[model samples]
Target: MKLQLRYLLVFAFLCFFSVSFAQRKKEIPQTTRLLFVLDASGSMNSAWEGDTRINIARQILSDMIDSIANVPYVEVAMRVYGHQYNFKQKNCQDSKLEVAFGSRNNNQIRTMLDGLQPKGTTPIAYSLEQATKDFPNDGKDTRNVIVMITDGIEACDGDPCAISRGLQQKGIFLKPFIVGMGIEPKYAKGFECMGRFFNAKSSRQFKGFLQEVVKQTLGKTTVTVELLDERNQPREANVHMAFIDQATDKARYNIVHFRDKGGKTDELDIDAIPTYDLIVYTTPPVLKKNVEIIGGRHNVIKVATPQGQLNIVQNGSLDYSTGHSAIVQKQGNHEILVNQQVNEPHNYLIGNYRVEVLTRPTTVFENVRVNQGKTTTLNVKRPGVVTILNKLSGYGSIYVVKSDGSEDWVMNLPEKGIPRTNFALQPGRYRFVFRSSEANDSSYSKSVFFNLSEGGAFTLDILRL
Candidate 1:
């Protein structure tokens, strides 16, 4: 009795652990790097809230650093623009990384910001372009973020919208959180397409916007994809998927969907920044656009991707000696989606399809319905064998006779005919015409007609010497 009780307890523990692990995911460490881009243009020296805009930015950023300094698995860096040259110099390329990403280095960034001055042009585009190199080359588990605090538009000829878009498309970092200080409508409109834009008209609003950006940056995000069936249940699995960043027009991630033995789909952890367009690679493929994933939570994205199985099988004689294939195409369009092998079951998204079996005489099935969670079985009558015996080398071709006495060409015999050959053909009337390879005149051709009454029946023909 004690032995049985111990076994049951061990089994329960394992089951609980598996469920917990799938839900919360394994406790693996993930890194998130925050690169702060501060604008120190000539306009920042103007008065704001009884203090210079540069001074206000420095103070608020320093406080923000204090809050994030103790965050585990998070590193911080800082970059400043327009501070190295004066306004008289008109330098549009003045940008430098004052502090590289490092752990426990909030003091380094804070000190650098204190001594900064708003002296030169606002090279917003150039600064953002150079910020790509600030991240490490390889970090599959890292999420890099950029928070740009600016007071002026781009003084350089570079396009800020295009530059930021290129970086986002390259996945150099998540969508940047751009906060503008007292930006006018015209200037704010320019930054709108750049990234997630926020306008901070007052010092309190700036602080609040900064804090909200920080809140968004914190947390390890995970995604739970539930591919639902026709009944809205997550019973569909075993398909590949591509997650594309719609705003950036870039494919961010690809994963194959699989269900655990306990009926739970596998969990995927990706950056929570972009709104994805999901493409499920079923037979015909299914697309779900603008899938929003939330940060700091298990973002469950449900896509109704029901699928059904298709099996093209022969009923009687399994003559696999001739490899048969079926051209699978969508109804009303002849575009071939898959060339499936005969007698095999394949999964396709629920739809109507046209299937053409590649046999000696082609068999076509139109408007074949594939329903969710069911197999649409298509059975072809087994074929009969046709044996041809020839004593001499010849050129010949076989044709299938239609009901109107017209014939469809099936195949051409080898120029060097064999002594005997066997062909698996459907039950139909066929004609064979032959001419010795040495015969150059059309009158030298000879013909023979044969019929296959039923499947599994053998028909033999001889080319008289």
Candidate 2:
């Protein structure tokens, strides 16, 4: 009888500790609200990539809807312009809303997209005005986004540029990302300017334009953690962490970095560690033994006592692989946070507190080349301090100070290595320079002269320094 009583007590203690470390997430859900203004005017009847503009628009809208449908707390609304284009009648009223503001199921959205037929004059400006009115402005904290995909210029009254400006002035809520789908080169500028107007042009190039917008909507943040290594400098590669659902103990971390479909270092694939919205990545100390972990929801994971501590690093993506292993060395109630929203007091409590240590991965990049008014591709063999001609780190923008120090060359690399941009720049001796928001003087890369005189197209790979 005493043995059974002890077992029950042990089980109760474990349960208490496990429940304490878990956190609760607030239900104040937010969404990256999106609006798609698709042009279905007669001009859209033209062919693009062997498909009609109407069909292409349908495909793009459908694909985007499918991609974002699974993400919780996201709502997408689409509006079709110039659906009833009437060149002979020249009626601006032909441009009207095909779908109102509301939640759209995939099939419903797809159906609405299919129903669009190109038949009216292109009142692209009128369509913009209509979209401007469609979005609700209840003064909520939602992030609104509007994406206008058109293949022609304004076909009715009101200047499209002025209309764009007006929308900005109004609380249309989100910024606009205009896409020129096979439109004339002359008009592409006007549409591109719309993105600039909203300060949404993260990339000056064309390839990753749309994809970058999507990535930005996914949300990004800087992870900062200070740890006492008792050794030399702390390295991120030695640390690991993962996203956990506050409701469950399921977790997954970045085990490897690969070139994503967009071909940029800004992406990481999160494998399913468990079928839970949140999971604890590290094996915490055994003092909180026999803890039950629920899967498939936002989870809360925390320590049981204040004595237990977790180590973290900053300035890079956190990795939760084996580095997040934890242990229990003390007893008492403790708290930890699973996937709590940023800056929220969403800590979970735990009994018999254990520490789950997480560390970030460190990367070293070398042999970076920076050229002026040139498109150069720098290949970092592995993730590390990538320098261009011994200048900037990682990828994107690389600044170079000339040997004579007479001028500065600000070179931009395509976020992805697109074939058109690969081997696109002329070869010359150059030095590397780093540009970052932080005021870290030592982070700058050393100056090196590199000549791209290989003549024929050749791949220059960057190795670890």
Best by lDDT: 1
Per-residue lDDT over 160-192 for candidate 1, one digit per residue giving the tens place of the 0 to 100 score: 899888888877887888998898878777897
TM-score of 1: 0.84
The residue-by-residue lDDT of candidate 2 on 1-465, one tens digit each, is 999999999999999877766633444656556777777778878765666767866776687677777776666787776666466777786655555545546777888887777777777677777776676776655656777777777777667776765665554543366766666666666665454312222122322445555555554422222211223222112123445422233343433222235432233333111122322233231132222232122222332211112222222222122222222232332444232121122121122323332211111122222222122221211111232331323443433334576544546554333322232222334344333333366554333344443232333333222
Which runs of model 2 end up more than 4 angstroms from their true locations? 1-24, 137-139, 196-210, 219-465
Q: How well does each candidate superpose onto the true structure, as a TM-score?
A: 0.84, 0.40
What is each predicted model's overall lDDT from 0 to 1? Answer: 0.85, 0.47
Identify the runs in model 1 with alpha carbons over 4 angstroms from their true place: 1-30, 46-52, 136-142, 165-174, 185-189, 201-205, 231-234, 244-252, 258-266, 289-292, 316-322, 458-462
What is the Å distance of residue 10 in model 2 from its true position?
A: 28
